[model samples]
Target: MANDTGKTTIDLGNLKAGGFIKERGKDLFTVRLRVPGGRMTVPRLKKIADVAEKFGGEFVHLSVRQSIELININFKDFDAVVAELGEGEQKVASCGARVRVPTACGGCEYNPNGLVDTQRSALEVDEKLFGTPTGHHKFKVGFAGCPFDCPKSATNDVGFQGAIWPELNKDECISCGLCAKSCAEGAITLGADGKPEFHPDACIYCGDCVKVCPTEAWKAAKKGYTVRIGGKWGRHPLVGTLFATFLPEDRVVDFITEVLAWYKEKADGAGRIRIGDIIIKEGTESLLDRLRAGFPDFVVAETIPPQAIATQVGK
Candidate 1:
């Protein structure tokens, strides 16, 4: 192909296998379709697959963010293709800047944490931060079912994980150390007079020890989650810093919504960088400052883990 000046066109045909990506509009730019939490009902998938076969390639590509990227779109036909997606009540937005996909647990069977249903919270987060903004770079968040880390929460721009408060029954403990055996992290141990000793630091907050206790000694702890931020898992993975544990389960959506708004205000255009990058350039203090600005009243600090080792012994 030649331009008006008769210059040869730059062909990226080699980059694609099936063939050069098809072009729809006057010019070429990649189009990213957001799918919150990597979820799509069967009907939703069917419609998108049809688009892929018609406008794009035969199938859409899955993304790490749980989003779908449909390439080779022409601006002219983009609207029609999107409309055909047929995701009832499904909303559309730019997947850049403040605009990005929201993520959540894809339904975990053993979620001991406070989080019950994540779909609603995921929607709220998207509504709050799904567009381009002056502040920091692209931010990413992960929602987890439990401490097992299905989506790798600790490495996101913001992370929310389920937690349980403890309910101890002194009368039932037989000093058998069954809880000690149950604790994979050795967070529990037998105390004097058949009671149990708790060492929160030793506890990873996993609740394994509590679950295995025969007498129902350790019931589900008060429900809640830990909010972590400024982390990334890439070439240089950074473990996010914990902002708070035990945020009321119901208010988490609002809390995160506020956090995104605050993040935007803090960076202005400069903050529009990734969480890991921001942490390096301005330091956690600056990020925290922006977070604090959003909610001056809320205190965000890491909560201590559980105390006591598992009961590996018997009465």
Candidate 2:
């Protein structure tokens, strides 16, 4: 749309939906690209650099969510910019009330602390759920390969942290006390009889005991994600509460879908309420009851309330 001055009147909502963030300058936008799990190929990155120099500012902005945003792009060059990005197979990210791109840590692929393929899960989520409208507010998801939680999973609306439940086989045990020494949480202690006694309550499920056991006595009885729900980081930062334990990797998508359904239904008419706020208003038990119908085995009967943190300015 053009105005009397012959300047293009852009639809800000439409542009934002297509990842064209309006800049302070007239007719300028920032093109945000989807980089799932923060993984990118060298050639593609080079192409992005070329595109940014040609159609936008000389430098690209790396968003905190791991997206590459081409800054200071003229609205008139939108088509050209998208066309150039397409050649590199780069798609624009979405904004508004939708599922944003997923962030992840380097998972079991190379990180020694990793216990799950978080990168793969992140890519899968981006493929299946990225940009799906949340109906109320923006929803974010993050994946951490293990309890180290390098990705800060608890700050997202839905988070997944890799976990392992270990089991000890007494028959194969060498009783060297290696597992006890390896337990950083002090969940394991050498028993009076020189055997290892595990305190499940203190275990963070990092799998260090299983990894350090020389006799292969400590084995992973279960390996999956510890799910956290209703987390959000903003002015009123709310740390997500544990919702489920050892959720199967294959069932992650289904689990998210169910949670979204509950959020959508519960958050209706609330006017831009986040999932965490809805949980606060409706109570965790309400969502848990709905989730239990589909994920009875994984849903927890009790969970700690989401923590509300005080945000300080100019501190």
Candidate 3:
């Protein structure tokens, strides 16, 4: 983990090769502060700004998950930076293959496809999944308020979507084509009598038609967060794929925490940072087996799943 002869030294702090470390050199360690749900009150933001100005570079960089990143500091000052960041509040997970930060569409309760608030749960997940690994590359996780990737969750190493199952009310079938139009993926269709019908497989759960339905007929079958894993958007450019269908809010954090630990073991110091390569060569089941070893019920063939092709989220 450390090299004494060369400038590269083992970073006790979760300094990732591709993250703040790459931006600054090996001698300098970078720290990422987790801002749960990518949201912080004005006071927290101010505290972060203060930390960056005093300890790190003059400007603080924002991460894809809405976390805070301060770069270009020597390893000597890294601990002090962390202590300052966690001065009053507990510093959440921000680096090392753990859940990066949380994301929500900022879509409030008024969103039609939603009957729940995903932002709160997204933050909860962030708290539960906070393990930093010292292998391969840095891992990131994200969440969405709806299927719409407001912050491009699909492109992360692990991602979440506020998933809702669409339920079609056969009795209140008034198909004015409004709902169909509202859906970017054409999940809804007009029947013979202009009634609305839905294709479950085709729906991405992006909260689009909820507000458009004047009759309040479009119903969510089940509200939860969908999960995706092993994606990155840099030189490697591998978009994360949808991994799970129904992940309830209470379980999202725990499930993701499990995923990170597994990924760390698989990395094993020689694994690739981009996860698509592993999935393509070793297969998802093989990957899951390494991650979920103890649970007899944890069957990748029956438990874990393959990722679906992502499309038509924000649109």
Candidate 4:
């Protein structure tokens, strides 16, 4: 039903269901479109442009999470634009205490520095978990192909970064120091024995040493995701600390689902409280204990606390 002004009165339910945010003008709303992994074909982009020209102000805004927004849309044209989007295989994005659209780096597809296929990982997570309600506050997930962290995964609710622990083959060591020079974090150094030694605790798993190795000395011993949890970006930003490492890609969706379910169970009555705030209220150790009991199969790795990460970045 339309109001006397001919604009649809959007309630909270409709806002969450339709992915439309009421604009300053009561007669207009902004529609959000999901672009998973920030990957889109040219034809889809052109179709969005056409729709925006017809309904919006002939322009679309790109959001920080890689979604597209068509602003200045009148309520009268909402159905038409939604129909056009469906024809193009584009779906409206969601908000309001739910799993938001997943963001990701370019991944190994084109980025020479990437360690894993982040786009594929992101799409898999989006398919399995996007729009699942948290019932307390918004939850965000992001993927970075490597420690370069183009998407700033560390600041999201849950973040995943590609990693590969390199193992040195001493027999093939030429002592050229290429790996040491390539390592931006100074995790690799030449030992008194003239062979290269690696400090696993200091490594960011960027795979720079593997790429620069002339001989087959540095090899990937393990490759997987470095997981971070209880992070957020808002009026008060908190960088998530490392929770696990070498987490296999196949188990990522399950891990995320279980984590969200746990959060819902714990924060059911806590209105508008973020997961990070919960961690602060009850120490991280307590949460980690519960998480460990829930998923014993997940391999835990050494973690870098938020303070250490900040100190390293400052240098």
Q: Which model scores highest in TM-score? A: 2
lDDT per residue (tens digit) for residues 30-145 in model 2: 98999989999998999999999898887899999999999999888777777777734898898889999999998999998899999999999999999989899999999999
lDDT of model 3 at residue 4? 70
C-alpha RMSD between model 3 and the true structure:
6.9
TM-scores, all models, native as reference = 0.73, 0.93, 0.71, 0.88
TM-score of 2: 0.93
- Which segments of model 1 are wrong by more than 4 Å? 1-30, 87-93, 109-116, 132-134, 174-176, 192-195, 233-237, 269-272, 275-315
Candidate 3: count of backbone clashes, pairs at least 3 residues apart or interchain: 3
Between prediction 2 and prediction 3, which has the larger lDDT?
A: 2
| Candidates 3 and 4 compared by TM-score, better number | 4
| Model 4 ranges off by over 4 Å | 1-18, 294-315
Identify the leading candidate in terms of lDDT. 2
Which lDDT values do the candidates have, in the order given?
A: 0.61, 0.90, 0.62, 0.82
- Model 3: lDDT of residue 264: 60
Give a tens-digit lDDT track for model 4, residues 81-158.
778777448878887888888999999988998999889988898888988888898999999999989998888888
Query: What's the true lDDT of residue 147 in model 3?
Result: 63
lDDT of 2 at 109: 94
